[model samples]
Target: MSREESAAQARLREAAAARIRAARPELADAYDLASAEGLLAVRARIAEDTAAPEHLAAVVIGRFDLASWARATCEFALGLDPEQAAAWRRSFTRTVFLAGNPDNLRERFSFAHFADDGSAAWTDPGPAADSAGLRRLLKLFDGPRPLPVRADTVVEIPPRAGRRPDRPPVHRELHIAASGCRVSDALVHLNHLLAEAVLDGLIRPGDTLTIRHAPRLTGLTDRFAALRVDTDPTLPGRLRAAAGLTEEALLVPHHRP
Candidate 1:
């Protein structure tokens, strides 16, 4: 591209970034991170021998949305906490924003995260990409929504009669089976199973499920895991058969006491 053309593209990139900030307001940091010059340096480092960053960045950039992704992580805590949410927004922005940059398209350009525990982080592809990436990431965030079958469904355990409202209930045991399944896919499958049981009337409103052995639903939501997952994979099948349940019941918030 010519200098004039490059300048024009630069201006357009700035304008596009401006539009996104105005539109999302919530994603302001993400926009800034994507447009920041510092990301250029991060992209440069990936031009070394590491291919993991490039492929991983592509996988994430193709499916990440800062707003929704943070919510998915924080929702495990309940709703959005502005401070924690801001931290997450910064995390994803700093990590994947530039990994998806048009200029950072070198074969060596890849991705990495700052987390001590080494979890994956991604970004929504830029607005100039026609929002295809944004739409895809948003879809992942949209669900495990409410099951349509309503039965005054207070599936959660009842609050202690004299307990203080400030005190949250203790977490119930969660059984996590070992599997090669991706966390996101597993969540969808489990949600469907739960929905099936509820629809079949096998699960009733106000019912609290204490599944002794079950497969843990994995995903961003699992970060704020309410269920204590079991490491043993064999037990879940046994428990499912013993209970005559074709699906593993998740002790989600709905089942929280």
Candidate 2:
């Protein structure tokens, strides 16, 4: 790439980052939009995949909408193609995971896995992960039959004095099956469901969440035999810590619903 072309691409990336920051201010502290690494990583992927970085970048940035861009970027990063694993990892390093109330979370916060290499794996709220995430979940299974997994929690949404009247707390439950998946995967899946419930306004901070797995699953009872809110102050932290994290991973607080 020529010096002028490189500079132009950098300018476009800065503009794109600004656009994203404007749309989601809460991410200002979460991601370093000024960094050139993310743009380089993304551009590399585009170049490798299509060998037309400038054209693809123009098309994606020409008429950008936050939602569509987020969806496309995430889907591309999570593509099942084995050959793109390195590219996907690079893309993920620039992505942020958004979880909480879908309305606010999608429009606000960002999440990422802090890596030892100083890169973060980020994901934004896009398509529901139920389908694709579940497909990935299936890969973790080890046995023939699916093991039952359930997570329940109660949320107390305190009323605003003048805005609304006091209401009772509500209970929420999420159920899934793991066919001999590792205890860790099962816990991660439960955490995913819990995050979804939080997005749906069914779970909230300070709420106690309980995970129930089939007794037959070895080592599960030992790890999360009687997990509760008192034991784990932050439910989302579990998802952040479960996997895809390195020894140097730093835990950042997620938005509360």
Candidate 3:
């Protein structure tokens, strides 16, 4: 990429990182969990369950809103007064439309995977997402499903507050894009490590980052991402150590529309 293009890219990622850095406490907790032992256990379990990084990434970051909302409504059904239900309905509508798996439609799309190379693997949220979000929620409103008769089931549906991630899970894309060699492996490996850090909680989503992989004199390197992470030339080992990374993998950054 040209110097101008690179600079613009850097700015975009910076904005994302800034948002992540400035996140509220409740939302930050989820990002902070990236490095916790429990999250590590979750990652380990996920790795054991799948051989593909794509599968691992999916489990790490898939946004499961439909099911969560349903459970929440059921638990608070009796408490859902007319106004509360309307509010929830509006919230639920926006959610299901943007994030739910609506079986009612002949064709449905999802952004469950994070796109590393900028290839849009699914239908991302757009300008009309809110109106459509509500419509989609209404379709799935088949009254209430059969809840098991039980005493006081607990429900916790924390509203996803603060700045939401603009894209869905693209962890695999980032990993593959960053797994490169010494010629310019710095950015690639660092980003790959960052993805794990995100899953592990070392790096929060929306935190601006940059890569320092030196471009070849002959041409630009194959390192591209939706948001380029700024890196410190002195602290490569720090990132590696934090993410428990030992090897370097590489790929060219190519965003397919």
lDDT of each: 0.30, 0.30, 0.29
Lowest-sum lDDT 10-residue window in model 1: 237-246
Q: Could you tell me which 10 consecutive residues in candidate 3 have the lowest summed lDDT?
A: 53-62
**44-72 in candidate 1: lDDT tens per residue?**
43345343212112223233332233222
Tens digit per residue, CA lDDT, model 3, 52-153: 222111111123222233222222232223443333322211122122333322244343332232221222222343235444443332212322222322
After TM-score superposition, what is the CA distance of residue 185 in candidate 3 from its true location, in Å?
8.4
Cα distance off (Å), candidate 3, residue 53? 13
Q: Stretches of candidate 2 above 4 Å error?
A: 1-167, 172-179, 215-257
Q: What is the per-residue lDDT of model 2 for residues 221-251, given as tens digits with 9 covering 90 to 100?
A: 1232111111112332111112110111122
Clashes of each: 6, 7, 29
Q: What is the C-alpha RMSD of each candidate to the true structure, in Å?
A: 21.2, 22.8, 20.1
For model 1, what is the C-alpha lDDT against the true structure? 0.30
